[model samples]
Target: MTNLKIALIGNPNVGKTSLFNALTGMNQRVGNYPGITVERKVGNFSLNNQTQATIIDLPGVYSINPTSTDEEVALQVFFDQTNKDYPDVVVVVAEAENLKRNLLLFLQIRDLGFPTLLCINMADQMQKKGISIDIPALEKKLNTKIVLTSTRQQEGIDQLKSEILALVNAPTTSPFDIKTINPEYFSAIEKNFPTIPPFKVWMALTQNFFSTEIPLDKIEHFRQNHSIDVKKIQHKEVVKRYQFINEVLKKTYTLDTTKETDVRMKLDRIFTHKIFGYVQFIIILGVIFGAVFELAKFPMDFIEGSFEDLSNWVLDTFPKGKLTDLIANGVLMGLSGVLMFVPQISILFLLIAILEDSGYMSRMVFLMDKIMRPFGLNGKSVIPLVSGTACAIPAIMAARNIENPKERFITMLITPFTTCSARIPIYIIIISVIIPQTYIAGFIPLQALVMVGMYAVGFVVAMLAGKLLSKLLKYKQESYFIIEMPTYKVPIFKNVLLTVYEKVLSYITNAGKIILALSIILWFLGSHGGENYNNAEEIVTQSEAAQTMDKEELEFAIAKYESENSYIGKIGQAIQPIFAPLGYDWKTSIGILTSFAARETFVGTLSTLYNLGDDFEEQETQIIERMKNEKRPDGTPVFGLATGLSLLMFYAFAMQCTSTIAITKKELNSWKWTAYQMFGMTIFAYIMALLVYQLVK
Candidate 1:
């Protein structure tokens, strides 16, 4: 069978992802483009059971002229024919209603001399919007096959696949002449680089970074000899292409303005209102937070209880030994700490997916832009900030969407302040233990309100940090905020499910590895120790306190004594003084140290440490119960309100995740800035936590 490669390219919010999902279904895998953090999504399908086709969903771009890394990646795939992702055919997905605006990108791709097909998406909305296209005429004029697809209705998918197959064997052609923009200048360049396509040469000259067979010094020499005005040439090209697009669209497309309704405009008015927009957003956030805590309760309980039982079963069924102890007390206990919070994480991602699918997220961006601009950010920064709620690794990667270096840098540095799902496990456990389970106004759960407040604190701190960074890192390059408002539609369930599944799975897989390793190590440290640990039984038995204790109480006393002198305990004791100001004991100090690896590991570390001495047959061990009963040497409760709040504030601001730190380095491309971000945020978190504990205590 012949193998064919296809690339899907389009402007943002043009139903491109929806069409990709429809075409590929569950046959897709997401990865990063080599040597870059830009996400690459590839899927496989058989065409007519004869040709095997691999389709790449390229990052969205407005035009061949790139402004951001995302657009640059899209251009590079085409610019370098030797690129692994270079396609045999390109499918330019366009919106049915917004064909005029979408055609600019289509024409640019068409002129690249690829065997391109125009996939007009969202055809189901044509009649509702009173829009109609002459597909045959448009295809003839553009010199390509056109397929009208409605992903929601599953329309034209078979036809699209067939067209893609046919196009693979079709001859490539450039719809517009490059010489049309500047006959004299382009003609000279075409002569100089006769082997290269004139359009590719032009792109290579205009782009800041381009991959090509041509030597860089030669291109620089050519630029120096010709003294070319790149911006002028780019402007002329856009004007020429739009001139051609306007003529083609005017004759082949028609819209009945009278038949269209003002529902969208009215909704936009309400959603974008200055006063009510924020009000609605707050209400939506409340509902999401409420659902996260309330709906996840039953499943969280089930997971926690299930893990408890599994641990007990492992202890009871397996022969008593080190391996059995490791499985029961280390791995299972550690995993349960993070896994029990999956339901809440899943719900958060699900709601975020829905908001994005319905296009309400765009309005939030627009609403927040005014507030953001005064700080170092614009509306585009809102995406990375909002995405940070899921995970900072991808959230930092999402900053690539911002064209300006300054804003993008600030966004990356500050995004970790937003409470990610990793922090959720820590926050939920802490909040539940400290806050009362009561509601305000007889309906709103106070716990949920506190959760929302934690989110608010993170966001507010992020904004302030952005402002300070903007002042510190001076850049004069002005950036405009431009975003397309997609037509609102009922979110596709498949897309939402896929998004939630991918995000939650990513969280588990990434956090699982770190937690597993740390859990076993922690268990070892807590299980065995130096001479002190071995002598713990004798030490406790001979104590005056042991004289009045019964057998059960005496065993408990020995276990406690052993834990205080264990290997992990010695390490924690050495560092306890550093965290003592914040009311942290040796165990809490150990959790804080492990948290630097990943915030979620703090809970798992604590779980593994506390469960090491569990008598599973006599009683079930839960991390929360163990923590609640913990006391300091002086008999004061360890997890008092002051300490709980302090921990929350620390995680809220700290740069804890190693993955996030690595991605930040990659995105910023400077260890200087990365160090500044890491140490600065951690120091700030420490001070804030210290202040909170002192004031509240």
Candidate 2:
């Protein structure tokens, strides 16, 4: 009859979030808390006509006492009773294949005294592999209800929902009936702090009493009454808990080793070989990047044209004024912001999801460990590099698995150099305008070939940077890459669709909001300025009297003045001398600055600049021609080979995504590192651009 909060909690790679997505559908919102890196995902679904339930998908963690930042966020929800609303029922999702390993967290949740249900996921995989679970027997043993689910097949979903609904009425159960820890120590803790839950006290002890300050009176009582050393006692209790899990699994599960070796081992030998493994890994990654770039072009062109037509139509229907300018320049630009990257981002996520689902990503990590070691990184940092191609933010967060501090810090520092999809829009716009479209080898467009070359440059440079950093930073920690290569299975269509949906929607929700706000603010600045800037028409008329200039010349001069005097223009001018050696004018300088917000803003900024006096479609030819024929103070073309090459270098290496900065801050555990990344990348990009510009010029 009312709403309830249900949480899906589990260790990483157990498909907890997948189950949550299957249940919640499109009713979801993603954002962060005011002061945390943890992504809070809450979605609502109705269990019946009379009752609604909200599901919270917390980040995956091994245990409540966390060593990693993400794990700490998960632990906060579990440990902080002061949280406004704790889950009404905890669904402990565990993989049926790795039941024992997964149950470690499940048992811990049960000890928290929540009304709990054990969800044994991946049931289909178990059946296919000739593994089976006696669900009722296991449920009775743990004293908890069980739901066998295969989220990929949509199996047991209805039954799971019904069980969760029933949990609202079922009494809470202590499934992790602790029998291993010394009873005297547990008794002493409970007796010392009368109000503190016995389980919380035990968790606090296991975590070495981290942040758990008992009242002064309770602390005095405990110290006076007992002679236990807290650290030594806590260490002994943790060992005992794992010892208990090992014993429980011994009786309950059986594995067929001979059958396991049939395919999984045979595959692993080739996939993780000392020499061939790294080679195979590189080939796989190259193919993924190569395929997405080629296959996504047709759809990208279609979307580009569709947005152009849409903007033109809007400009035609609306009368010219401040409002129409805002619609054509601001809103259309914002929608284009959302549309332009759909093809590349969609294909990227599709490929990544398939690899991740098949568990090939893990194998790739293990293989790359040898190479990554010399670069101050281990196998786990490979995900961040791969993900950085789509966006560095998620890639940076994925570095959570890298336990080594020095390696992780370097991984975060260098990930921005791995060309991301945000850079795609910048590459497309510039390559089309500058790189000639004549056939290379009388076949492929030279422009497209150049774009591909630029991407390769970014990848090569990123690896080289990583290797150099590894040598410079003297780390002697013994680090190795251990990975699990799961059995191959057909990628579930629903899971693929859900993953793409979530990633794409996130791009739109987060990046779109930033672009929309910036575009409006930019429009206001370009439209209304003080003194000679206020009236463009009058200023152009006054300038035309001296030379009897043509309409195009008069308009160009007026546009230059308006851009120079606008608020953003002042910023561009202030920074222009820094870029002037690279053959960039104030306008190009502004594009570079705005691009850090997002690389897609390159076209949007350029469009806004020229479209101040006319519609975007109408000015497309003029804008291209202006860039082509326009000259510098030294009378050289503004966009010759020199400036074009320079611009490409800048976009290729720059730290150009705001979302990435936010994520880096979260992952590195400080704004200090985020600042270092931004400043370091900017200076690096500037130097590379300068050298390229001078050589070409």
Candidate 3:
């Protein structure tokens, strides 16, 4: 079968990915570019039995002259001929409402002389907002095929596909004439690179093409070495395109400004209020987190119990062996660990989509900017923080919108500190295990209040970190936060469903792989080792010292010996000395190490290490019993209130998510920052945990 490479490119929030899903269905993978952290989404679909097409969904951008890393990736993928994998055809998805702004990008692609197909998406919104376009005129003027599509309505999708297939077979036609900088300048370039595309020459002259791609030796040796002010030239080009768009719209479209205040604007006025807007935003977010933990409790309980029941059933049915133990104790534990968090994560993202669709998020940035001034964070940085709850990777990506370099960098650094939904399961289990259920103000459970307090600590620490970095970095840029509040329409069900599907799938897929791998590795580490390991050394020694102990006491002592000397026990032993001052035993040490893959794995790791031999719920009960009665070498209880609080504090501040570190490296453009972040966060966590443990103990 012949393979065709096609790219879907457009401005952000243009539903490009949705269209890609509509085309590719479930066969998709979420990956990052080999070197950079930019998301790489590629999928395959059959155009015909004879031809299979591979589709790449490129990052959204405003123009080829890239500013952000994502935009740069898009440009490199499109313009860098050395890549040998450039798309055969570019599908430009443009939002119908923002045609003028969207057209600028489309025109840039067209000028590149590539096989370009224009998709005027969100066509349904156009009619509702009183927008009409002369389709034939647009096609004729742009000299490219146009497909009017409404992804939400599922309109014009088949038409779009047909147009795409036809584009492959249709003979190439040079679209519009390239706009000239000056007649003399163009003529001179035309003479110099006679065989080359005129726009290609212009791109080189303007440095839109990378420095190496331009013939520096040839340029210096010829053409009188005339220097061009390319920045000025590019600005003129933008003006020209806008001028053309203004003219085209005069004939092809009309808008009714008399449409009164849109629901988007009305909602924004309240949600983005200078004072009330921010309070409401905070309260709304508080509700989201609160709801995820409180309201989802029943379902999470059911999932936890179900998994426990399944594990016990397996233990009863299967003959005892290493493989049986691994399956019941490791794989099931890992799967349960990941699956338990799905409900909370899904609800968190659902709230996020609602806020975004209601157009309240953009205004929250504006409202919060004034308040964040005291905390050293740009108000714009809040978006990344808000989104960080879903995943730190995209949250870090969103930080690019902060124009101030120092602010952006600091935001990227601290975003991981925010408790993402991936940590929800870990937090829930640990808090339940540690915190007492007493109420403070007659209603708020002490546990819930502590959860809120942890969030506050994270926010305060992030603010302080941002402020410190802002002062440390000497470079200055005027901080400005301005965003177009998109018109609010009723939240489209399909769009929300698609978003939740993509984000949740990305999380589960990544977490499942890592959790499963780490679980198996941990199981092996905890299962295999030394002759005297998991032996009766402690019990034998105690019995030898005194024959006065009763059999029940001896039996208890033997169980402790077996647990402390188990394969996992020995591994944790070597590291136990490090965290001893923090009131943690060897098992806690193993939990910490295993949790680096994902924080929530801590509870499951402990369950496995203890040989609880039950599912998640049963393990929780066993854990409570074990922790309550566990002893140190001195026979002191392992987890009193002090130790429990210490563990809780440690998780609250620690950088435990490997995916977050991976994203940090990608966003900061170096391992240096990622290293600094991990080290600094770990050290900070250690110090804080030490202080709390020391004071309480």
| Best model number under lDDT | 1
lDDT of 2 at 388: 73
For model 2, the local distance difference test gives 0.72
Q: What digit string (tens of lDDT, one per residue) describes model 1 on residues 2-87?
A: 88999999988898888988988889877666655566778988888789889999887788777665456656888776888888
Could you arrange the candidates by TM-score from highest to lowest? 1, 3, 2
Error of 1 at 68 (Å): 1.3
Q: Which stretches of candidate 2 lie over 4 Å from their true place?
A: 25-34, 45-51, 132-136, 165-179, 194-197, 206-235, 256-261, 298-304, 373-380, 387-413, 420-484, 528-575, 580-652, 656-680, 687-697
Task: Identify the superior model by TM-score, candidate 1 or candidate 2.
Answer: 1
Residue pairs in collision within model 3: 308-615, 526-568, 534-565
lDDT of 3 by residue, 67-167 (tens): 65445655777666676447788899988778888888888877665788999887878766767788898888777899988766789988877787777
In Å, residue 557's CA in model 3 sits off its true spot by 3.5
TM-score of each: 0.84, 0.78, 0.79
The sequence of per-residue lDDT tens digits that candidate 2 reaches over residues 159-205 is 99999999877766565545446678777776776676566666654
* Model 1 residue 615 CA deviation in Å: 14
Stretches off by above 4 angstroms in model 1 are: 208-211, 380-458, 472-478, 580-652, 655-679, 689-697
